[model samples]
Target: MIGANSVLTLAVNIGIAAISYVMTIRMIPRFREMFIKANLYGKDLCKKDEKVVPESLGVLIGCVFLVAMFFFIPIPFTFGDAASAEVATTGGRSEVFPYKEFVELIAALLSICCMILLGFADDVLDLRWRHKLLLPTIATLPLLMVYYVNYNSTTVIMPKFARMFVGNTLDIGIFYYVYMGMLAVFCTNAINILAGINGLEVGQSIVIAGSILLYNTCEFLLQHQLDAHLFSMYLMLPFLAVSLALWKYNRYPSQVFVGDTYCYFAGMTFAVVGILGHFSKTLILFFIPQILNFLYSIPQLFHFVPCPRHRLPKYDSNTDLLTISTVTFRAEELNFIGKQMVNIFRFLKLISWKDHADGRITTNNFTLINFVLVIFGPVHENIVTYMLLGLQVICSIVAFFIRYPLANLFYDT
Candidate 1:
């Protein structure tokens, strides 16, 4: 049964979510103005003209989330039992200030804040892709340190097939930290890569956060579990609230841009929840679409195919439609190795390329957005966003089902 502290914790969690949402909604205009005044504007490449937009309003959401943390996180709460209540209340409120898990979560929050700053630096400096790749790894050090100090279980249960070959659990030892560090790097960059359209980054994040909220609720009610899920809800709810706020201005015909800051902030929230809440594997399942997109873009990313600075769809001012952005490269520019790779991609329908009479090869950029355009064939930007978000919802729902009911068929949860 739920106890008094649990009830209070729920009340605080729900209240803070509502408060954060309202705070973000009310403050968005102000933040946009601040961004404008600071000369932090970006050209919307999805438009034919260089449409300027106020950028990095995600700083508002990040700040609001951090400020909200200071209020509810330190309050003493427990999952179940009177002993937990004693641990919460018997000690003076002041004594509960330094609770271990709470400290860990706070550390995670600080790490995310640092990541947001790193993204802001990128927004200002326009860091190279190589530089951007390593910055998230640096930003995640504190989070990884806390995880190492608190819970260092590097053991992963072997799949049934793997178990057949080598029996039971496999301890990965030190590689586990490397795996987590890569997860942090991947989560941050994956969202950053699939971006360039209105609301795609924040929209997908909202869908993932909602899926996680549903999972946490299920664990709380169906499994009679708490703690970790409750902590997850604390992060997820605020993230959803703030992301929705950003989406308002970032949707079709956007008034402002969320910039990379939001991407890092959003991804790090997932990383923190997954790692600290002990559901990193399940959380990754929710990101299958992003992961698939990243995998699909690998050839272009490694320079076997040309990677553009902006992979946004071509914006036709006359039609006000976003179509595929085709890139052309001279045949000689692609060496024998690049030519063979392009042939493989074309056969897979992962790319559409043609050799012109002028000895230039033209092809659509390899990106989730461009791939969606290729499939649907030049729909409006809003329609494309809706379609992709629908796919994300479906993927997240299927992941949840796989982790829950189909556990025996898939492998143990």
Candidate 2:
């Protein structure tokens, strides 16, 4: 049940979240000039005038979230202890620490800290693509280790249709653990690769976090694993607070860039909540757009098609509109297999492309930002961002539908 103490703790956390929001908003303006002086600035490629704005300000959210989490730790443990003190005294079971929960909390914090460090390093060093993709795997090890130590449920339910062939569940053993690690990597890179336009990254983050927060609240009220859902809520509230603050300036007609730092930290934060809350599958549903973006990008990612340095939409200075960018392929550069894959993409109309008179081919880059541009045919930046945000919202609704009503048809409750 949702007790008085739980309600009180939530109120206190809301206060803390509000303060985090204020701190982040104030810090952004202050950090702007300092960062520019340090040459940590980027040209707004989407803008007509191309203003040089302070970049990598997303590290601020990481810092503020960390600080809030550190100072706020005592509240949860103390309150839980206070709530159960009478049982401890009367039952004479003796005092016992909530050791498992404590370890989980500490592990989550340490893992997030590692991601923040890695993200900042990427921004400063401009590491290679290989390092960029694989370093997050290293950062996720702490989380996997803690999961293995604390609550290692390696079994998963079989779909109702497949149950007759096997059984109700399958013990996947170590492969389940493998899936968790890959989730972390995918989450980090998914957010990174889907971004380019102003406010798109942070805006999508807020939508996903908010959707998870909503789900947690529902699960808590339904009294199904209240503690786990509460654990999830604590992490998400502060994230939304900080992310909303960052999004304010990062949004269309942007004032600041969120940088790779914010994306990594934000992705890892979602991963932590989903893993610790015991809802990783449900968490993934909210990422439909990201998943689609990745699938569309497979050809370019594997080098079957030529991938540009930046796959973001192109800006038309004269029209002040952004159009979908393209990847170019020359016959000599592509192998047989690559050419086949490219032809498959074109035949399916999965992409829009043209055969140049100069014996070259050009096709739309496989990114969600550009995909949206292709659909709408070059609109205003604000309009494109809003449409993407709307898409995120719609995906959340679809996720809930699949999780609840639709899921009953596929699996046992």
Candidate 3:
């Protein structure tokens, strides 16, 4: 039995999503044209018949979402008609405006806007990996500070078994803040690294957002207190709508590249929801694929193996198939210890290598894209994109179930 206020909230959310969808769909073409005229185009590497496409069109998504949020978020109008202010009675107590919650929402929205700007800067400047990685840490500071100020509970409930050994809850204190900051950085960069092909960035984002929305809906229904999950849904639903609309031009045969703008914006939106809704742990569960991909690339990222600027799949113009891109390591580039590590990974088949006569060795770039190419052999670009997105969907579903029903077995849910 859902309440009237809940029903009204649902209706309002749907209306907002509808508006965002229509506006994004209509605005994409104009943004694409603007990007093209501005000479902000990048080569499409996934397709054999690739052409330069307008990039950084995520500006449209960011603008539309922010505008829609500001206009439609139902902030109370407390002008001269102060007595006409809406009120609701819960347990014989009258409730007015949720000032604190609304303020938190505003802070979160502002942080996301900052991330959008940071991402756009990366798009235009072609920032170094270190700069790109560190910038998001700065952009997310506002939201994290708000989280610290508003709700500073650093105590987490232990698992049922752990509770028996220790206590019901443990206070992590300031380490929690560091964890939250790392989570923000990881979320932003994880999606950034997983991108290359058409639609991959925005496509995985749609799947992740949809998964969160579904899980949040479940929590809202099952939990007696609805506010926390409702806050998450408010952000997630509109994000899904806008991303779906963006998917039109970002899909196979992509007309516009979303650039890093969409990735940072989308990732920050998820972080904002998790922080504000007090469910950051559950949010990480939904990012299983991104997490795995990040871990898989860490060695190359840290120079344990050679890394190229871009690890996009090799496109066979004649066969119209995508294959793994290889990275070559110079003999002088590795120490004895690093070569030993490389041999271990190669023997484990996590990587493959060919020693050349010119004192060089070539191995496949270690990324999820290359891994897919390895297992599936040469595949069409669209097929690879869809496969990756499908993998995301499956992983998110497993994560949702693990955090819900299966959670009861491990934790006192």
Best by TM-score: 2
Better of 2 and 3 by TM-score: 2
Task: Judging by lDDT, tell me the better candidate of 1 and 3.
Answer: 3
Question: What digit string (tens of lDDT, one per residue) describes model 3 on residues 211-312?
Answer: 888887787778733666777877888889999999999998898899899999999999888888888899999899998888778778888777888888
Model 3 stretches astray by more than 4 angstroms:
75-95
TM-score of every candidate: 0.92, 0.95, 0.92
- 155-246 in candidate 1: lDDT tens per residue? 98887777987778888998988878888888888888888888888899999899999989888886544777877887887788788877
Candidate 3 lDDT trough over 10 residues, lowest sum: 75-84
lDDT of 2 by residue, 102-163 (tens): 77778889989999999999999988789877877888888888888988898889998998
Task: Count backbone clashes in candidate 3.
Answer: 0
Candidate 3 lands at a TM-score of 0.92
Worst 10 residues of 1 by lDDT: 77-86
